[model samples]
Target: MAILATEGLTKRFPRVTALDELTVMAGTGVTGLVGANGAGKSTLIKILLGLLPPTSGRARVLDLDAATHGLEIRRLVGYMPEHDCLPPDVSATEFVVHMAQMSGLPRTAARERAADTLRHVGLHEERYRPIGGYSTGMRQRVKLAQALVHDPRLVFLDEPTNGLDPQGRDEMLALIRRIGTEFGISVLVTSHLLGELERVCDHVIVIDAGRLLRSSAIGDFTQASQAIAVEVEDGLEPLVERLGGLGEAVAVQGRLLTVQVPADADPGRTYDAVRDAVCDLGLNLVRLEQRRGHIEDVFKEPVA
Candidate 1:
């Protein structure tokens, strides 16, 4: 079942159209919302969260109408905005507990849940420190902690890795994966970096200029291409000539030769032909593997 769905959703600002007839369905698990800046990713999240009303069309969250059940939807969904929204004077524990209470938790229960959530997010003794004293990674964790503290069924994480170093980004990504896989909470994570999502998302939805570009499983997005790359220890020129003579479209790049495997031809035959060509030229095969497609490939196509 889909946790979120949109039909012909459109949102317009005073002079710009943020979302233009966007339609998409997101299932349970980690679904990535990928697009460049001004691609309508944040606008879509706002609409789905019932914070912004669309100019046209309809949207639903957890099978509830976003237009009519905005308050109810907010209760079940947690949001971590892109920009820093934390209060610098308050400690992480205090802020999280306050958020839980605002979400309708009693004082005692909110404190208990906040403590457990802070621990789960890897915030130990530092969680009691004021937000102004925390590092970038620790602040990100505090943001994540509040989102999960309310025991929300779903979370919308917008640019969770913004302004972090390499190590911090890796840790945040791992925590996001754990939230979806280990905790079983459906996640809609938005990021401008396309390659990063490939490692964490089960499915991806690409949007360009507020329009749906492509939506599919992550595996389908990065399926194997129709070319195989071959590398040899020596006799590069001879192997290229031999492979070209065998009716293969070959392109040389430094020490590697990329051969196009014909669609109508057997793939195994291509592998065998490569092996035979190397053997005939007395060259040692170093590596021969199909060049797999990447999530970035989708951006190369014209927007639909």
Candidate 2:
């Protein structure tokens, strides 16, 4: 079932059009909403959450019309905004319990859920400290904890990894995957980083300039191409020349060489050609593997 959908959805400000005839659908599991800044990602999220109205078209969430059932939808949807909107003075436990209660949980259940959610997000004694004293990663965890405290069926996480370090980003990504797989909550995560989404998302939807660019399963986006990627420890240029001399279509991408396998040619022959070239040059082979597509490849094609 579609968790959320937009049909010819558009939103315009007096000076700018944030969304332009945008239409897309997201189902179960972790679906990634990928686009650059100013790509109308935030606007689309607002419309889906029933926080903002569209200039044209329709949006539905959890089979409820976003325009008409916004209050009920908000009750069942959790949102973790991209920016740091947490209160500086309150402790994580306090803030999260308050949010849970606001989501309509009773005081006892709210406190209990808040504590469990905080622990699930990796907070312990530190959860009692004022949010202002917490690190960026801890603050992000608090945000995530509140979003899950009420146990919503789906979450709209906007750049949850923003301002996180490399390790922190990895941790956050794991947590997101756990939300979808372990907790059984559907996710619609937004990010400008294609690599991050590629790692955790089951599906990806690409948008550019407020228009749909491409939407497909993560496997479809990263399918293996009829090309091999070669890397050598030394004599990179010489290896390229040797492969080209053998009539191979070779392109250099930084330290890696991408050699295309012709439609009629045998893949084993291409592998042999690469192996022989590296051997003749006495260059140390680093990596020789099939090249796969990436979510970033969507930007390489013209918008359809």
Every model's TM-score: 0.78, 0.79
Top TM-score model: 2
Q: Tell me model 2's lDDT, rounded to 2 decimals.
A: 0.89
Error of 2 at 299 (Å): 0.7
* Least well predicted 10-residue stretch by lDDT in candidate 1: 289-298
Which number leads on lDDT?
2
CA-lDDT, candidates in order: 0.88, 0.89
Residue-level lDDT of model 1, residues 19-122, one tens digit each, is 99988999999999999988998989898888899999999999999988999999999898888889999999999999999999999999999999999889
Question: Which sections of candidate 1 miss by over 4 Å?
Answer: 223-295, 302-304
Deviation in Å, model 1, residue 97 alpha carbon: 0.4
- Our model 2 lands, by Cα RMSD against the true structure, at 5.0
Candidate 2 residue pairs in clash (backbone atoms < 3 Å)? none
